[model samples]
Target: MMTQNLLVELLVEELPPKSLKQLGQSFAQLLAASLEAQGLMNQNAVVTAFATPRRLAVHIGNVAAQAADKAITQKLMPVKVGLDAQRQATPPLLKKLASLGADASVVPQLKRELDGKTETLFWDSIATGTSLTDGLQKALQETITQLPISKVMTYQLADGWQSVNFVRPVHALVALHGADIVPINILGLQAGRETQGHRFAAKVNPIALHNADSYAQQLSTEGAVIASFAERRAEITRQLTSAASQEQLTLIDDDALLDEVTALVEHPNVLIGKFDAAFLQVPQECLILTMKANQKYFPLLDAQGKLANKFLLVSNIRPIDPAQVIAGNERVVRSRLADAKFFFDQDRKKTLASRVPELDKVVYHNKLGSQGLRMHYVRAIAKMIGEQLGGDALANQAYEAATLAKADLLTDMVGEFPELQGIMGRYYAQHEGLDDDIALAIEDHYKPRFAGDELPCKPIGVCVALADKLATLVDMFNIGEFPTGDKDPFALRRHALGIIRILLEKKLPLKLDELIQQAIKIINDDAILQQWENSSNSSEGIAVRRMALTLTNHAYIAEEVPVLHKKLQEFIYERLAGSLREQGYTAQEVDAVLGLDPPLPLILKDILKRLVAVRAFAILPEAISLAAANKRVGNILKKAKTEGFDNLSLEELSLHLRSDPQEPAEQKLYNALIDISDITNTALSTDDYVTFLQAQAALKLPIDDFFDYVMVNVEDKVLRNRRLTLLANLHSLMNRIADLSKLAT
Candidate 1:
């Protein structure tokens, strides 16, 4: 057998748990490549790995003893002493070969020109074998430099040496070929028969590993340590499940939490720990978060499906008294619960809505403004959305929700734990007995904190959510927070995505500029709010109502409104286009359809359904001929001077169609024009955009013939004008489906 029983190990400082598995995998690859490079592997070999947070080790068995001798072909000049010009081995070639081992008697040299190069060649097998010692040395040296390092470090392995780079400071290494230690330096430690067991478990001076299998057994016998993560995990689960069964309680499934638990110990021993049942008075989420997030304990669910007030703690070491270990863990969990209760109770002191004014002191962003300012922005846009939806019931609820939506930010509970922003708002609103719609909207404003979560459900909630997100987007835009590629540091993309979901799902009737102006007015505290205060008294409710109304109104109602209103429309259009494409429309179709009406959903819905459906009926000769007519007229107009297109005159239709009924061009043009009114009416009645496209297609053949049969450019001004007028009428009718000529197939 080749010195096959080989064990190799890489010992290092603690490795990141997530990175350890892959690192272990790479070590085996490096070793395999070295073996393959030196041609050392054979059929009987096997390689395996054992990893821990602290070290990665590899073992190979039944390895080859020595490399197989390699065979190579050589081409040498042919020797000729008594050969004819026929090109065969001569007596001189035979004499030279006989000198080696009488092989000349059987061997022959031949001459032939190959690939434009003439050569005489003699074949011989050259066997080169490698010694076990030489091959092992070279393989070890080659692997050292190529080893993957976590961060890259230097550690010396030579006797009385200084430093060299390594993944970590290696405490020791072990490598063996049967009874003898294989000498190789890795991370400042020479490989040998000795390897340590679990650090804390077998902190003995040094442990001797007699052979391959003894490495694991000898260490365990020496100390209560199990280093294999998989084995440790299985043992922990078995114990925890068994313990929970004994108590008639079920354990919650938490794979992610268990992974963290696995990384913490070399030898895992699951122990049941308990705390006062009264502490369960806190909400279950807080209790679980406290145990798992703070204490790393698995919670037990009771027979009634409520939290059992019990926890499972996986320990690295067996304590002298198991009860003492349980007690210590309970104490820590209790302290966390106490803190949670304190914060929860303190939050109940003041109503969340009443605390809104306090947000003025809180900074949202250094450049973006304060939390109070953000509230004004979100509220203004919310009210605007309410008006857009045009329902007094929903609009009223939305107005109230917007004013109180961000009130939780000022609450002590939220301040203590910012993650509880919406949760605290829900709790505080319920405590104050606010309208359920208002309370729900207040809590659900931030419904989708991430993509693919959930959007607000109720109309009031949806409107306010849209308003809040819009205000944030506009403020960021005003401050120049445009996103590029993958880097939306402020999450502008997320805000845009939320806006799209709100519009698409709620299908709200909204004008993008009206919404943006509301957003801008919310943030325009200096411009609009300054004017409102000058003309109105804050104490008078009547003046407040009037000022609120005046704030959202625009002078021209379109042109004189805020610039961000237009910017918002542009943004909404892009987002709408992208969203519709995701819903399975071509990009150009979305642009063409969305372009016909304002994005105010009511207007879009009013016009888009008919327009879209009309396109479907437009497919026959009507649509084809119309598309053709528009294409012809467009091509002619395009080729003509870049000046204005001549306006159509019915006098030309009078001259051509009526004067000469036999004229093919004029006859075809008259028929196509006759269908325009009926075609548009049929498409509109069907409510199918496809019908409209089909109708346009019907016109294609006649339109093509009209342009082909007649000379549109004539020496006489009257005839040319008449043909051009007929073409213009065709373009006007065909454009309803789409600017057919602008479409590129």
Candidate 2:
């Protein structure tokens, strides 16, 4: 088989910057995967992805001109159904062979094999290799079809009557095998060697690629474009660093922003721009966000990590003078910063407390009433959590923070930039001479907005943060807005994970079930319901009134609260299981710890200790035998219960054991359990799970002997019941730390 490097490119209108990186990587991977599946490319072939604002391309090394032929064996029908009494092919066999392009002459060549007690016939054939032209066409079509495009645009082709749907309108397609053009068509465009590049700065209008290997070099030399997304991003980073170093400042580090900028320009030329120093009076968050979100510029920071007056911008075209370009960017950014400053100044004119009344006009959810009503729920929950965690002082601070948390939604700064909701509240609170704890809590309550993000640093902040996330989870689950698959419009999974992270990482002595119950109670309180009813009736909007009525109706909440608690509990545990696995714990270890039932309250603070203890116990020499023994004992108890032993009290079942034990194995096991009872109880009382589990290793020999020499199902009813009760007690002692049976395998 002859092989050559392959290059493919699709030219179109400027692609979305945010999705360009993913789109390029997907295109290359999907194309290479398709070729590998078709046997036209090796599994280890090197695949390079190229993406810019206007194109997505890939270069795959060592793709064959045609795939190697493969030998295949396919199963036919069973011999009993296919062969006649005389060992001749039946009509069905003939039809099957005919469908496979075979005839009766080849019937003797069919192989016979046993397929689950019945002899089956097998047909062997050689499949022809796929030519590069056909393979590339199929791969290209499949890749385009599978691209992770969120939205597709439908547009008419040059023919005017024919239309095609794609992420953008197709302009040209390039496909090359070595130096030869592969004859492939996609999106109504035929493959060619010509492609347009660098709309304004290209040395040549249409750079004619000479071969597959020359694609990148030719684009750089003649097209005035850096085709590789990563390479372009590196150049921008290098230039930004060099420029910032010369000015004694550092650029704000944001990889997502860097990737977006890389996708926005083909030739990145980093240039310095400046804004008025007066704008620094506003919060640095406001200034940095305005620059990044609106103008896509990198805000420079000083030595102390404070925002500098200067910023860096990447330009698509490099000019010799560069003065006009720098001036133009400065002008645009100055206007944006001015707008941000104006919003900030206007917002602080009134304190956050004064803006609380306006939240009623803002609907949090149509079915959940207004933000004002939601605030009431959050304040109550926060105060409850604070009271539990701290004393009345922390509770008062949490209530104050929760009361004003959503007030910033009405501010000019937050209204213009919704991302600044809690941030502006913090700033406004500070301006009003509020306590530092309260101000910080207002901002930090939304802490851990995503995975691995920090939790609230203070007790008051932790309370409000927990309350906010819990309220969201309970309310969303109550309304049946449960997240299904990847469609988490309300981000319930994120909310659940946030709550789990806070509870576990903060080491707060809070029980998962308790917090959930408290949140449900607060939301369903009659006082809160009455408040919601009054607000809804006074509001002018009919939708608001109807939603409030639905929410206040006690019957709807009563039916949903129990289901919501169970579902939310399961959801949180599921997230915790996944998080634990990601942190490198084995599935068996996680399962054993998480498999506890209703008696256990799922104390988040102690889950890690339990998992650590389980991991340590798993490595013990006696762990496997004890785990298996536990499983056997469980089965015996379950059988005994099924045989009407369930109604017998432990005293009734163990009545004969008070006198004497008939079996030595049972006596040895019973004595061992008694010996370890005090030690295990002390260990458990101190929450020393490792010591508790380690103490059980002493029972391994006796437990194995009991299971081997003792017949638990003896015909003597009293003896059998006594053994069953002994096994039940052993099961309880063994599983106090974790379900050892999950580790049996």
Candidate 3:
């Protein structure tokens, strides 16, 4: 079989910077997949994708000029309907054969087979393979139709009135099978061997590709363009590093920025530019964000990672003098920085406390009230959480912090850059001469903003952060604004995960249920006022709505409070389980540890400690047997309840054990549990769960003997209840740290 490398390209106007990389890769993969499906390429074929600001191309190796012919089986009419009584060709068989380009002479060669009690006539034939031209054409069409384009542009074709939609206006399409043009058309452009190069830097206007193998080289050498997106990005990185090294600074590394820059230029010329030192007075985060987000420039940092006055920008043109490009970019960036500094200076004149009232005008949600009302809830919850964790001092600090957390939403700086919301609050709070804890808390309340992000560093911040997230969950859930499927309009899932992360990672002495209750109380306290203000425009209408909402919420709170709390708790635990599994805990292990019933769920403060213990316990030599025994014990207890032993409470069963005679095996098991109870209880009290599980491991022999020699479902009522109680006691002791039954395979 003969094979040749294939190349295809589509020249167009500038593509979307963010989607360019994905588009280029998808094009190549889809084309190659279509070819393989048609038997034109093999598994060993390699695909190379090329994407630039003005073009998308691909080079595939080991693609055949034509696919191999395929053998196909065709079913004709049934035997009785196709043949006459004398077994001669009938009119139906003759007509079918004629339609297949065969005549009556070939009807005798047809094979007969039984298909579901019906004798069917079948024919075997070879279908001609598809040529490269046709296969490439189909593949190209499929690739375009399936391209993951978030948006498309419509432009008139050469016919003027005829318009087509594409990611960008298409200029040229090139398709080559080895040296021959595999003729095709896409986006109203006919395939050809000629494609234009860099607008200003190419040596030639139209660089004619000689073969599919030489597309990249020809473009780079003659056209002065980096044809491959990866190669172009690498060149930009190298240039940035070299330029930054010459200035004794480091370029901030952001992969997303790198990709966007790569898609914005066919040829990159990294240049260092400078802004006035006065702009550095603004916070580095503000300056850095403006440069990266507004100007698409990379800010340089000093040895200690402090933002330097100088920045780097990539230009598409490489002029001989290059001074004009460098100066032009520096001027544009200076203007952006000045605006940022202006916002910073103007925002500082008004203290965060004064801005608090302005948040009342800014609606946080249509159903929920404004940011002002939400802050009230946050303040209440934060103070309560602080008091629970510490005392009145911490409570006061947390209250103060929560009071001004959203004040920056009204600040000019944060208004211009919403990403700087909490950050600007911290800066403004410090400028207002607030305490360090309160200032940090204002900003740190939004910490762990993303996955793997750090949580608040101080206790004040932790209290406010937890309260803010809890308020969001409780309020949103109260109004029936829960997340459905992947659509979480309020980011309720993120708030839940944030809550779990703080509780588990910070080792906070907080109960999940207690926190939910605190948030619920705050939510209920302000429900009428908030709902009324949001529901109506006039004071009289507001009063009417307020009363209605109060009456409705009274009923809602009574019925849905426990239900929503459980759901939210389950949501948080699910997110935690996913996070833990991603961090390397097995699903079974996570389930086992989370399956433990909490007395106050404040015990969840020790969840991490228990998880570590569970992992260690799982590695014990007797772990499998113990886990199986626990599962068997659970089944026996479940069966006992079904058999009229309805009162399965540990307390009730313990009372029955007082008068009930225990079997010999049960007595021994009881003795073993009693022996380890003291040590296990001491270890648990000291948060030494690993030691507790290890102590419980000593009961393996007695538990195994109890299961082996004892019949838990004996005929006598008293005997069964006593054995059930013994198993319950054993179950409770073994699972003091985790649910061992969940660990059973």
What would the per-residue lDDT of candidate 3 be over residues 1-745, giving only the tens digit for each residue? 7999999999988899999999999988999999988889997899999999898899999889899999988898999999999988889888898888878776767899998899999988888899888999999999998999988788899999889988888989999989989877878888999999899889997999999999999999999999899999999999999999999999888999999999999989998889988888899999999999998999999999999999999999989998999898888888898899999999999999988876666666655656676787788889999999889999999999999999999888988999998999989888888998899999999977987789999999999999999988877776667788989988888888888888888888788877886677667664645554664343343344235435546313566667767876777778878888987988888888887765336445677787899999999998888899988888887787677663456556556656664556666787788788889989978989898888877888988888788887788876776677777778778877788888888
TM-score of each: 0.65, 0.89, 0.92
Question: Candidate 1 versus the native: TM-score?
Answer: 0.65
Would you give me the overall lDDT of model 3?
Answer: 0.85
Assess candidate 3 and give its TM-score to the true structure: 0.92
Where does candidate 2 clash, by residue pair?
Answer: none
Minimum summed lDDT over a 10-residue window in model 3 is located at 536-545
Query: Between the candidate structures 1 and 2, which one is better when assessed by lDDT?
Result: 2
| lDDT for each residue of candidate 1 in 260-322, tens digit (9 for 90 to 100) | 677667677899888888877665666777688778899999988799878899988776778
Per residue, candidate 2 scores C-alpha lDDT tens digits across 1-745 of 7899999999999999999999999999999999999999999999999999999999999999999999999899999888999989999999998998889998898899998998999988888899999999999999999999999999999999899989999899999999999999999999999999799999996999999999999999999899999999999999999999999998889999999999999999999889889999999999999999999999999999999999999999999899999999888888888898888888878888888877777878877767887888899999999899888987888999999988888988888898987888889899989998888899999988888888888888899999999988877766667788889998888888888889999898999998998898788676766766575543544345346536654323567667667877888899989999998999999999998643478788799999999999999999999999888877777777777763345566445665766888988888899899899989989999999999999999999898779988888876777787788888988988889998998
Clashing pairs in 3: none
User: Candidates sorted by lDDT, descending order?
Assistant: 2, 3, 1
Which 10-residue window in model 2 sums to the lowest lDDT? 537-546
